[model samples]
Target: MATPDALAFRFFSLQVVRTESLGPSLVRVTFAGDDLAHFHSDGRDQSLSLFLPAEGRSKPAVPFEEGENWYQAWRELPDDVRAVMRSYTLRALRRDPDEIDIDFVLHGVEPGAAVAAGPASRWAADAKPGAEVVLIGPAVADNRAIRFRPAEGTDLVLMWGDETALPALLASLESLPAGLPVRAWVEVPHAGDVQDVVTAADAEVTWLVRDESSAEGAFPALDAIRAAGLPSARKPYVWLAGEAGRMKELRRHFVGERGVDRRQVTFVGYWRRGLTEEQLREQPQE
Candidate 1:
């Protein structure tokens, strides 16, 4: 098959206009720029890189470059080098001359959470109006082209994720076929961590608490899902995302044991356990 245009993965720059708390653990930052008019809306999960200044410092601005070396400079950056580049999802897009809003989930004081949280959180916490930040790639669309064509009609769609995957999950939910039924299975560490999600689709949402399960291999939430079983043998589409190892296990259970058609599933490794933000992109996906 012919490949999609290279522009599909392109990015642009924007300045933060404001920030607000989504919950105790999430930050919503709104940005706008003339370049956003060119933002691509390919209906796939998109990612971006935000550069943040080191702690105990004023915001720093990097001049945007229209060349490849800019990205190289970012990648080759060494630690102990104050500046940082963090990766995050583009949760929503607006195209009235290029303005977009992105949400960054905060890490609190946890070190592991910091790897999943990025410059977006850093900026959201401390950035001020007029602060400039460059938005990186929408990062090449998923290899699998998704079509919402009503082939094997179904009564519902099942969606699940942890805090790490919430942004993408939220975006995906908004794009589902209008009136299609959906069931959301979300697992968050704390009760206050949950935030209201805005989606037009018909959905039955459920939240899971981590303490209810064992230390490992003991997910009562997942078990609940397994017990509930697939929506139907007609095969409802399933979406799974979160930490790399956890997502892999869920994928195996869903595909290996349940025998769901591979084409009807969208499983993603949003991050890996113990990997720093910079190390996350290097972890390969299956």
Candidate 2:
């Protein structure tokens, strides 16, 4: 059940091209790879599952070894044995035949925490001129199936998300229809989390802060949105993501109560308040 080297079109060894702090909590590590020329450009905003080895391992334990298959290994792996792999989004990808760049967000606490934690974080921390790490997934172009196309005569685009969805939000805005008015609502843990965002459309941004509590708990920003009402009478195309429950509330307020076209709204529950990524994966779709 191991992914074969012949099937390795999905695999790559990307070097850390550079690193930058986009905001207080977000770290962007640009990756360059030889195989990047083959990456599909449509994969932007799609989640990528990365398998990282321990600090000193020469070669990663690929899913299935000669003696055991990947699925059997997965079934028998100890709790600690499997925590090394993490899934993250393909925030952005720029492909040149000789190289490519992929951005990753950091999460955790330590000195220079954003730069020193998580697999990608640690990789970027120790990464040097020629350091390399494996990458596997469709390129931005191939991953664009999840992408939403603007409807004809659309006047506005509305987007909402928390930190988990920033990569997607940023990528989406970058590709939004030019000349359309756009409004985006984003929630983050603190005011320091705000980052300069660039977009192709006419833009208005509202940053929702959650210092004493999680962004999903009685969020004042969402309440404010409810009170202000949607700005366009024609109604904007809405896209929302973040905590599952909070997104549900917003969806109800928009499509249920506000009478927005159901097809015009897209909502994604990127995470749950108290669940681990694994737990969130097990959740039944509502």
Return the top candidate by TM-score. 1
Candidate 2 lDDT by residue in tens digits, 104-203: 4455644644433556556544555555566556644433336555577778787788887878787778876567788789888767778777877888
User: Which regions of candidate 2 deviate over 4 angstroms?
Assistant: 1-9, 54-60, 64-83, 97-105, 110-132, 139-145, 213-216, 233-235
Model 1 residue runs over 4 Å out of place are 1-4, 42-44, 54-66, 77-83, 95-98, 110-120, 138-155, 212-217
Prediction 1 global C-alpha lDDT: 0.66
Worst 10 residues of 2 by lDDT: 59-68
Residue-level lDDT of model 1, residues 1-286, one tens digit each, is 2236544555466678888767666768888877776665554356566666655545433334425455566455454444566766767776654667777766653465534444546557776777766665543444223222223676667777888777777777777666777888888777887767677778777888678346766766668777764445466677887877776677777778777676777777767767776687666645
RMSD of each: 4.4, 4.6
Q: If scored against the real structure, what TM-score would every candidate get?
A: 0.79, 0.78
